[model samples]
Target: MKNLKIDREKVLLGVAGPVLALVVAFLLTALVLIVSGYNPFEPFELMFGAIGEQDVQVLIINQTGVYYLAALAVAIGFRMNLFNIGVDGQYRLAAMLSAVVGAHFSPPGFLHIVLIVVTAMLVGSFWAGIAGVLKVTRGVNEVVSTIMLNYIATSLIAWLTLKDQFGYQAEGSNDLTTGEISKSGWFPGIHVSDLAGDIYGFIFVAAGVGVVYWYVLTRTRFGFDLRASGASESAAAASGVDSKRMVLTAMLASGAVAGLAGMPVLLGQTHTYSQSFPTGVGFTGITIALLGRNSPVGIAFAALLMAFIEKSASQLSYATPPYPPEIADIMKGLIVLSVVISYELVRRYGLKRQQSRVGRELAAQAAKNRKEVSA
Candidate 1:
């Protein structure tokens, strides 16, 4: 019971870290405002109003899917301590390939659309597998390899977009992109109240990810082995778990999910891929993973929180005083830094508490045994 109480206290402490960080960050911002001779309270007041505005809310909603998908990519790899910096390359290449497939195939209906989406996942997984295979076979450091691969993937996609063989050619056009996909291949939007439907659908998808990923990590034998391998390769190997195989599988799975981040942009918004695809999403995944502490549910909230800040930053700038847009980036950095440090602190504290509780319990048991023997 004492142990349980300590565990509960640790959990509360973990939860409090983020809240504490927020307060600290706000106070720091207030200090900055004072130094700058600006009214700190005024900006915050305007921020509150901007958040309540409809257009700003919609913008935030739209960003939910993008952040959720990107974060999932980094979180999966983080679970294994694999730094998948090539998420950008994998996601972009898969988006281009999937876009081409979607455009060329001209699927007739829903089933065909499903097939195309699945194909995208395969392409994404395959792309990521390249890095995983390199790591497993040659002992290549994923950080260096993934970063190098990002350049290669970017060049390859750029070349493909301009080449005639890949069907990216236009008769007399400078833009290097394939034609738009058929309407049937699109992910249909949903209607939630008076607002746009894409956000609602995205929220549902994010929730699904949380549920499925949680199950995959906790309930399955594969998850157990993956976690074991992540914790220690030597220990896992001694236990007969193939660390290499798990690494490869986890990387592939992570990339597949990252690829899905483009689904909203490809199937819903743009209905096609282009050379000027959104790039920072994969990198942002790293920050999201840190903020989320590698938990799927935590990632969802982190993503949403990030999306809200980004959305509001833009709208608030337009509505009130034109503060520097880079403020959003600064805040994101601070949040991620705070969360990572807080998570580590909480984890360490929890472990210490458990150890102390066990020691006390054993000591008490020993004393009781001694008394009984004397009697």
Candidate 2:
């Protein structure tokens, strides 16, 4: 009963942060709308109404999968006290190379897909490992190394996708692309309704990744070591945990997951890496990871919320008395800011509550001791 109560309290406290953030964000966004001579409630109404459309629903779910994967990648580094800011570079580079391989080869049925995914993971890990190696060997900060790597990766992709290189211009289109993968290599999608289109089959893969992430972090000795090292390297060292190795391992794991972020679109939809391929997902992952508090379940919800906001934002300019599409961007920015402030506030409040409880218990014990002495 005591344990259950403690767990319940922890859950409530955990939830309090995000809830407070959303409330504050919504209010702030409304104020902005009012100042801009727009109806704040109308935007919310339209956004909520957009959810009724089957196609929009499908888009949200599919995008959520991508966001979830990216956020998970970021969360992995966060858990190890490492800031892997290059997830964008890692995943983009992985996707491009993997797409090239998929285009060039067609193995057996499922084996083809497996090969592409494995290739992507390997590429992502390799890229991220550079930052990790630099951090451990040369005492480089991951933030600086990863940021530089992102630029390097971007330039590398641009070069590799040139017409004479691994890329080709499709007839009737000027956009450069890594030629399409064989149909056998394409991931199958789940059909729901004709209007809705197929949901990305890789969503299941994302879910599995989340389950694995939760299990590994909570159930394994390595997870404990990683967590301990993140909490305090000196304390972890005293406990015989190797901090450098853990940092490297975390980066590798993070990059591997980052590799999967683009597979949903590549295998399930586009079937190729092109100039139009999505970007900035890795940076968005950082926001989601922060908003999710680095938990799998929390990240899932955060991903959905972000996806919904993005999808809903697309219709703003087309609506009656159309609002600027930038409204959504404003809301997102406010939410991020609100989340940071709200979480800090909640932390301080919880700390004070805990301290008060401890003081009360001490006082009660002192009173009992005084009574015993008088007797």
lDDT of 1 by residue, 1-375 (tens): 977986788678766766666666666666676687766676566666777777667667767777888788888887777999888888888888888888888756886567666776787788888899999999999899888988998888877776664646467876667678877887776644565334435456656876788899889999888888888989999999989999999999988987777777787677767767788788877777777677787777778788877777664466445666666777777776666677677778778977997899999999999999999
Which of the numbered candidates is closest to the native, going by highest TM-score? 2
Clashes of 2: 0
| Candidate 1 local Cα displacement, residue 77, angstroms | 1.4
> Which candidate ranks first by lDDT, i.e. highest?
2
Question: How displaced is residue 60 in candidate 2, in Å?
Answer: 0.2
Q: Where does candidate 2 have its weakest 10-residue lDDT segment?
A: 312-321
Q: Give the distance in Å from residue 102's predicted Cα in candidate 2 to where it truly belongs.
A: 0.2
